[model samples]
Target: MIGLCLGLAGLVWAQVPTPAFTLAWDHTIEKIRWEEDYRVTPQGLLLGEARVRGSGAGMEIPEGAELKDGSWRYHRTLPPLQPLRVGRTPEAGDYQLCFDEQCHVLSEWLGPPTAEQPALELWSCAQVE
Candidate 1:
């Protein structure tokens, strides 16, 4: 009975969800567009992107954007004056943008902006998965 209990406990512990990785970037890259590619991997979800932007606030990379070899690629018509590296672990909280073998961006609070700041903020979210 004790062995069975221990096995059950082990199963339960293994079932516990892993924490998401949190990544933060400057608020400036919010202007440029971004994309994410999702894939299934042994490590849960893998995210990658083709482009990222850099600005004064810091750096802005697409959320849920795919990552490869711990690095991502960003492209622009005009070579980025400055590029910011993306792909850091995320924190939990039902993020507005999340990547888990798939890209999903919350649409509830997402819509057209009322003001310039709101417009920019909304644009920033659009870049996320």
Candidate 2:
């Protein structure tokens, strides 16, 4: 099984079971929802798809994106990423990790934030122990 590790400052804070998952959040400026789907692979994490509720400053729809169900959807052909960093602030609310038809706030999984650890990091790891 593949393990998705959520960490702070190079320390693993929590491990979530995953073959695939979606990371979603609202744009800090526009408040529009953005979602990215990823799959855990042996090499790393592979991005499967992305969608956005609407476009705004710094939220441009991709050239080949399709508008469907009030959102712009697109697929990317980028290489697998080893570690993904997500910055968080006390005021910006929480990031959602969705899978198995349910969503959970990141902060809820890892507990409260700290003054030093301002960002959450995600990476593929060995089976959760």
Candidate 3:
């Protein structure tokens, strides 16, 4: 029984993939900051925290949301993906980060980070204070 339990746990852990890279954005001019930690698994992509910044509005998205067609709701249901790309996600030219309550539009394309860039894991939550 213990061995079977261990096997099941291992199987579940193996399926929960970790992200290859971190993501972040700061539109300080508009006082907007977005940070997300994500990973793609066989089931779909998983997002954590999804902390918000800049919008005095206190918008919060519950964790454990899956990335489906660029959108995730309070429930874990996912949207649809296009070909090899996950829908509604940032790419190079077309991307949309829509949370349960708020959405932050992103470019589909991304460029290399600059020296002035802050650490991905620890970007400031709020530009003001």
Candidate 4:
């Protein structure tokens, strides 16, 4: 009986989910900017710039702009190549930044949503800051 109980306990412990950490954005929407420097095999390097915006407001990230009301979401298809470098902020919540092998910032918001019914949404590229 003791061995059976210990075995069951071990099984339950294995079923537990991994703990997740929250990530905070340093700059606000106004200050936030997405700059991608691409490097080609033959060529050297290319710089590209894009603006980040909210889904509802559609307001562009200005200088020193902060995220008003948003949560970090993740996507399975587009996984980030490296772990996210999180900062200090209260808006942060339970989430994990997904990355790929290359260690590129593939997706910041790539995890399950808070609510189950509404369904989780995943945004990519400039959309994620």
Best candidate according to TM-score? 2
Q: Indicate the residue-level lDDT of 61 in model 3.
A: 48
Q: Write the per-residue lDDT of candidate 3 for residues 1-102, one digit (tens) a residue.
A: 000000111221111112222344543335455555544333334444454443434444457654444434334334311111222222222223343344
- Which runs in model 4 stand beyond 4 Å of their true positions? 1-18, 28-76, 83-129
RMSD, each candidate, Å? 15.7, 1.4, 15.7, 17.0
Question: lDDT of model 4 at residue 52?
Answer: 38
Across 55-104, the per-residue lDDT of candidate 4 in tens digits comes to 33344345544443342222223233221122322332322222222222
Mark the 10 consecutive residues where model 1 has the least summed lDDT. 1-10
Query: Mind giving the per-residue lDDT tens digits that candidate 1 earns over 1-129?
Result: 000000111221111122231222323234433343332233333343344433234454546544554544543333211111222222212122333443333222233222322211110111111
Off by over 4 Å in 2: 113-115
* TM-score of candidate 1 versus the correct structure, residues matched by position: 0.25
Model 1 off-target regions past 4 Å?
Answer: 1-30, 60-105, 108-129
Candidate 3: misplaced stretches above 4 Å?
A: 1-20, 56-129
Candidate 2 residue-wise lDDT, 39-123, digit = tens:
9887888999899999899988999999999889999998888788888876666799998999898877886655566788888
